[model samples]
Target: MSDPILKARGLNKRYGKVTAIDNCDFDLMPGEILAVIGDNGAGKSTLIKALSGAVQPDSGKIWLDGQEVAFASPNDARANGIETVYQTLAMSPALSITDNMFMGRELRKPGLMGKLFRTLDKKAMEDFAREKLAELGLMTIQNINQAVETLSGGQRQGVAVARAAAFGSRVIILDEPTAALGVKESRRVLELILDVRSRGIPIILISHNMPHVFEVADRIHIHRLGKRAAVIRPSDFSMSDAVAIMTGAMEPPASMAA
Candidate 1:
C-alpha cells in the first residue's frame, strides 16, 4: 500500500526480567482500522502504551508520516497528532459535554492588559462541539450542558471519540472500546469507529471481541506471548482463521504471519 501514517519497527517493552512486548512491527494507514487481538498478557496493552507514549519501550523505532519520532510522554504523543482513548473514558461525570470537549484546551478571551483572561467562550465552544458531534451522527444530543454520567454508554463513548477527533489528531487509538457495553451499545460504538475511519483518520483498535473486530477492522494483527504473531488483511482470512490465530490454536496464513 501507500506509505503508512504510523509505523513501528521492532517495538520491545520489558519489566525487569519479563519481556512484555517483543519485536512488534506494525503499520496503520489513513482511513483504515487495524485491530490487535491476543490473550491476556499477550502484550497488546504494552504495545499500545509504547505507541501512545504512556510507557517507554526498551528498544524500538517509531515513524510518523515517514519521519522518525520518539515521544517522552503522552502529551508528547498528542503533540505528534496521536490520541489515545482508554477504556475508562477518562471523563468527569458531572462535566457538561462542551466542558468535557474542551477540558484541557479551553477557549478564553484576553483581558486586563492580556495578563488576565475573561471567561470561556461558552457559546462558540458549544456550537463547535455540537457540530462535531453532529458530523459523527450524534446530533440526537440536544443539550451540550447535560452531565456525561446521564448519557448512555454508547453516547459517552461517542463523546470521547468526538473529543479525540476534535483535537485534530491524525491517528486515534481505542483500547477495548466495547468491552463493557451491551450488544446494541457495542454495535453503536463499532459504527462510530467506522464513521471515524471514513473521516480519513487512521485508527488502531485494540479489541478481543472477535465479531466486533471482524465487523470494523480492515486488518488484524495477532499478538502471541508478547510477540507479533501475524498481520492479516480481512479479505485474506475468514473469521474462523482469525479466531485460530487469536487463540493460538493455529498459525497465521504463511504470507501474513511471516
Candidate 2:
C-alpha cells in the first residue's frame, strides 16, 4: 500500500472546555473510499472540518502528499486539491448549473478581456461543466443552463458532487452525500460515488447510515468519545460489531486496531 494522500496527527479542538476533537489522528490513502462513522456528537464533523479548513484545530499537523500544510480557510484547502461538499450543498438555487459549478473559481476570457476587464468566459465554463457532467454520466441533467432551484434533490446532489469531481484534484470530502435522498436516489448517489473513485481520486465519506457505510467503504474509521476508536475493514467486522465499538460497548479486536 502507498503512503496516505492525506494525513493528520494529534488533532485537537475545543470550545470553552467542551472538547470537540481530542488527540485525533486520520489517514486517507490513495484511490480509496474511507468512511468516517460515529454516533451524534462523536466529533466526526469537527474532524472533517479541521481537515477541510472549515475549522482550525487548536494543535495538529496535516500533510498532503507528504508535504506539510496549514489551511487557514476552505479556499486554502481547495487550492491544495481538497474540496468538500457539505451536507447543505452550499449552492445558490437561482444560479444556473454551469454557474454553480464554477461558483468561486470562475473562468475568465483570454487576453485583456479576462486580464483587465475581468470578463467571465461563460462558453468555456459551460463547455467545461457540460463535459464534466457527461464524463460523470450526469448528463441526465439535460440542460446546463437550468436553474439549480428547478432541479430535484438528487439532481442537486449530483451537481454538487460533479463540481467537486471537476475541480478537486487530490481529495474530495463528502459529508453525508445520501442523507436527504429517496431510496432510488440514494442508490444513484452511491453509484456516483463509486464512479468518482473509479477516476482515481480518494474520497472521505462521512455518513451515519450503517448499511451504506458497510456497502461502499473499503475501511471504516469508528469515532468514539472525540477520537478514533478503531479502523476496521467492513468485511472483517459486522455492522453490529462496529456499533458496539462506537458506543463503547465492546473493544476492537487487536487485528483491527488503527
> For each candidate, how many residue pairs have backbone atoms clashing (under 3 Å)?
0, 0
Per-residue lDDT tens digits for candidate 2, residues 55-144, read 999998999999999999999999999999999999999999999999999999999999999999999999999999999889877899
lDDT tens digits, residue span 7-33, model 1 = 899988889898899888878887789
- Give candidate 1's error at residue 96 in angstroms: 1.4
* CA lDDT for candidate 1: 0.88
Candidate 2 colliding pairs: none
Name the runs in model 1 displaced over 4 angstroms. Answer: 110-115
Model 1 / residue 75 / CA error / Å = 1.4
Q: TM-score for model 2?
A: 0.98
Which candidate leads in TM-score? 2
| Cα lDDT for residue 124, candidate 1 | 83
